[model samples]
Target: MWITYFFSSLLRFISVVFYGEITTDFKPCIEFFYAETIPQGISGDYQALCQHYENQYHFATLYDRNRRIPLFSAYILSPGDGPRPKNTNWMIEPRLVSDKVNTGMEYQKHPDQNVKNSQAVNEDYKHSGYTRGHLAPSGHQQTEEDKEATFTLTNIAPQMEKFNNGPWNNLEDEMAERFKVCTSKMYVITGVMPYEKDEPKINNRVTVPEYFWTAYCCPTFTAGPDQNYFPTYAAVGRNDPNSKDDIVKKNTQDGHDVKEMSLEDLEKILQNRLKMPEMSLFKNKCKE
Candidate 1:
C-alpha cells in the first residue's frame, strides 16, 4: 500500500510539472474545482488555468492544449445584487502567453487550421458565426474586477448566437437569482461537451461544443421544505439546434433546449460523455 501510494503521489507531481502548476492565485479555492478525465491524446498537455485579474483568482479553467480552448471553468458565486457590469474587452491569458509548451505559430497564418497554443485572441472568434459564450458568467461575479476577469477569451466558447442570447442566457440569469437567495457561497462549474463524431470548428481554430452544462453546490442555505434540493442543482443546454434529442430534448419555446436536473444526474451525463467513469464536480460530492 505504501509503495503504491508513493508512486501515485510521484505521478501527480510529474503531471503538475508537465502541465504546469495550478496558478498560485487558485491555491486557496482549489478544493472547489473538480478533477476531470482529459480526453485521450491530450493528457500530457491539459492545463489547470486560474483566470487571474488584478492579482487575484477570479475563476479556474481546464484548458485543452491541443484544441487551444477551455474545457470548463469553475468559480464561486459571491453575494451580489443588481445588474451585471457591461461586457469588458476580451483578453488573452498571460500565463498561456508565457508557456513554452504552447509553441507553434504556424496556425496563426492559417485561420483554417487548428490553433495549438494556450491562448486565444479576438481574431479567432471574429465572423465565426458564433457568440463568445461565457463559461463563468460575469453576472455571478460580485466585484467589477471579477466581472472584467470573465471577459478573457479563455473563459469563452463558440456558441450559437441563438443559444447564447436565448435559453443559455436565461439559465445564467436563473442561476444568479438562485445564488442571491442562498445563505452561503455557491460553487459553480460550467463546461462544454464536444461532439462524439465530426466535431465542428470555428475559424478552424476552436472546436464548437455540442452541449453546455452547469452544476452548482451551495453547501449552506436556509433550511426549508426544499432543503433537500437547495444545496445542489445542475442543468444542461443543447448548443446545436440541428442535433437530435439523444442527450437533451429540445423545448418548444426556443430551439436551444435547457433542462434542469439534480447534480448526480448531471455528473452521470458528464461521466458518460467525458469518458470519466467517476466524474464528481464537487469534493466528495460536496457532502457535509
Candidate 2:
C-alpha cells in the first residue's frame, strides 16, 4: 500500500509538472498552514481557509463552519516597513459555500465536506456590540497582498472592542517587534477558546470567544542572556470583560487581561479544556 501511494504521488507530481494539471481519484482537504501542527478534537465542521494570490497561499486558517468564524489562523512573519494597508475589504469564501465555486480546485471534495455557508458578514457585527477580531493580524504581514488576505471574515471572530483595541493589540505589536529580531523563521498561531457558560453569539450568527490565545516559536534567534526563552512563548487574553479572573485576570486599567506563560503550560491548559491530551500547537513543540 505504501509503495502504491508513493508511486501515485510521484505520478501526480510528474503530471503536474508536464500537463499543468494532475488528476486524483481521492484528494484530502489540504491544510497549508498546519505544516507545523494542528490542534486536535475540535468539534463542529472545520475547513482549511487558504487565501491565494498570484497562485501562492498567502495565509491559512482553520475556519469553524458552525460558528461562522475561524478557530485559528497561522502565518509566517516577514519583515517590512511603512504604513500598513487600510483599504481591506472583508469577503466570504465562496468555495466554503459550494465546491463548484471556481476556487482554482482548492476544495477537491464535496462542499458539504467543507465549511458550511453560515454567511458571516460585516453587517453581523453592526449593533452587535462586538468587534471583528483578527486571528492572523494584518500588521504581521509584510506585503500588501498578505496584509489584505487577513481581511477575510473566515480569519475573524467576535471579540470585545476593548479587548481588540487594548491588550490584544499590544500583544500583536510585541510579537511584531520580536519577530523583527529573530534570526530565523517564526511561526505564530493565534486562536480563541469558547466560553464555558452562557456562550454569546453575535446577530445569532457568530459565536463570541471567551479567551484568545497565541503562541510563537522562533527556532533560531540571536544569543542572549535569556536564550532559553527566545525559542518559544505563549499567551492568553481575556475577551469577556465581565468574566471572572479564572483563566486570565482582569486588568481594569488596561481594559483587558492578558497573561504570558510557557508553551508547555499553555498546552496543559488546552489539553484539559479542549479535551485533547495530546494537543500540540507546534510540531514536536518546535524542538531543535
Candidate 3:
C-alpha cells in the first residue's frame, strides 16, 4: 500500500521535473553519481578546507561578503517520481569552487582549487576540532545512489549537536510536514552564516546558518503554487546568551562529544520556525 502511494507521487514528480508547467528557462545544475541506483538531479562536493568527507561527494560553497552566511542548495534525489521517502534525514554540504575536470572520483587538485587563500583560515577560528554538522541526515538513504548524493559537501554546515538538536532541529521538522502535503514539484535551498565582521573571521571552512529557506510548485496539491503550503523559508538560531543575540558561537571547539538532537522533534520543528516567504516562493504565484 505504501509503495503504491509512493510510486504515484513519483509519477507526479517526474512529470513536473521533466515537463511541468513552468515555462521559464531555469535549468537545475546536474551532476551524475555512480552507485546502485540513479540519484537526484543535483548534488554537490565538499569544500577542500573541510577535514572530513572530502573524497565522498561533490559540494558547492561560495563566500558572500554581504550576507554573513554562505548561500547553498540542499541535496535532492530523483526518487523516480515515487512516494516520498518515509525518511528525509540526509546531511548536506555546500560545494566549493572547483573545475569540472577535478570532480567525481578524480583526485587531481586544481591549482586554483585549494580553498582560496583569502577564505582559508589562519588560526582566527582555531581548528575547534569540530566536524561540520549536517542538517540533512544520510541515514535515511535507501540506496547507494541516494547515499552518494547526500555525501555532497554543499549540504553541510559547521554545527554543534546542542544547536543541531535545539532550535535548528525544530526548523527541519516544520519543513518535513510542509513537504508531505505539497502537491507541486519543489526544490529547497539552505545555507550557513558567519559572525559579523570582527569576530575573528574563522577561515577554517566553518559556517553558521544565518537563515535557511526552500521553494517549489506542485499544482497537484493546488491549482497553482500555494505559497501558504510550503513557501520560501528563513530561520535564525536563538542568539547566544553571552552575545546579547543569544546565539551559541562554539561551546566545544575541541570537537569531542558531538551532540544529537531529539529524534521526535526533527519534523514539526522545521515547519514552525521557518518564516512564511522563507517557506513560500520569492514572488507571489499569482504575480508570476
Candidate 4:
C-alpha cells in the first residue's frame, strides 16, 4: 500500500501511450499476440505474429521527454479466432493473459490487479503506489485487430512506481524523439521491476525483473544481413545486463549498453546464449 510519488511524470507518459480503450469480445479469453516468433528460452504453448495494428503504423506515444524511448510492450497478432497452431517443435510459448505463467501472481492477491476500463485515465492509477503498467503499448502492432490482441496478459511485466516514471520512462521519451528526428520507425519493448538486489525489500513476495531488453529496426535506415530494416536496438532493465543470468544480485548498476543485431542472430543468442525464450530488444549476459 506504500507507493512513491516521484515517478509522476513517467506514469503520465505511460498513461498517454498505453491510453485508449480495449473492448472485450465476451469470450473467457481474448487472443493477444499471434506469436509471430516463438520465444527461445522459456518453454510452453507458443505462437508468433503481430498483436495489434497492421503494416506501417506509428505505435501509441507516451511523452517522457527524457530517455527518448517508449516504455511499452507489443506483439504481432494473427487475424481472427481460430485454433492456435499446435506444434511441440515450436521454440516459443503461446500464452493466455489470465494464465498463471503470464500473470506473475494471482490477480486477486497481487499488489496491483490488471484493470480493464476505457473510462479510467492514466491519473486514475498513477498514485496507487503501483506502476501504471502496460500489458501492451505498441510498436509492431499496426492494425486495430493487432492492437486489441496485445491487450492480453502474455505481454505484461512487473514494473516499478519510480523507475516507471523515472529513468525508465525517459527511455521512452528518447526513443520517440529519435523517431521524429530521424523520421524513422522502430519496434520497442519496455518493462519494470519490484526491487533491486540491494534495495530495501518490499513485500516478501513481489517478483522483480532480473533484466529486460527490446529489439527494433528502422527500415528507413540500414538493413542488416538479416534484411530487417530497423536499427539494431539494445537496452536492458535494472536487474541484469549479462546475456544469460536472472539472479537478482547479478543485476547491478552501470546500465547495460544496447547493441545492434540481426533477427536471426537475435534469435540464436536468445535461444542458446541468453536463455530467455522470448524476443526482446534487451538482453543480459549470464556469467558461466
Q: How many Å off is the CA of 237 in candidate 3?
A: 2.8
Would you estimate the TM-scores of all the predictions?
Answer: 0.80, 0.80, 0.45, 0.39
Candidate 4: give its CA RMSD in angstroms: 17.2
- lDDT-superior candidate, 2 or 4: 2
lDDT of 4 at 38: 17
In terms of lDDT, which candidate is strongest?
A: 1
Q: Which stretches of candidate 3 lie over 4 Å from their true place?
A: 1-70, 74-102, 105-131, 135-143, 200-228, 231-234, 239-288
lDDT of 3 by residue, 1-288 (tens): 999999999986764454232212122222211111121221122222221233543222333422223344333312333333444333222233333433332122232334333232223224653334443334323344444444333344455555555555565555555555555433443444334444322353444543333222233343334344433334445322233322323454331221222212212333233211112222243122
Query: Residue by residue across 181-232, what tens digits does model 2's lDDT show?
Result: 6887788889888877677898776889888999988888887655666688
> In order, how many clashes per candidate?
0, 0, 64, 67
- lDDT, candidate 4, 1-288, per-residue tens: 125565776665453333211112111222221122212233222222222222322222211111111223443211233332232110111222232343211122122233221112223333434442343443323445444434333344445545455554565445444454333334343433222344221132223344444444343443335333334444444433432444222333444433334455545544543234444332322101
**Local error of candidate 4 at 278, Å?**
11
What would the per-residue lDDT of candidate 1 be over residues 130-246, giving only the tens digit for each residue? 888999988888888778778877788889998998888998887777776678778888988888889988777688899999988887787765566667889999999877787
The window of 10 residues in a row where model 2 has the poorest summed lDDT is 20-29
Model 4 Cα displacement at 70 (Å)? 17
Ranking by TM-score: 1, 2, 3, 4
Compute the lDDT of residue 194 as modeled in candidate 3.
38
Per-candidate Cα lDDT values, in order, are 0.72, 0.71, 0.35, 0.34
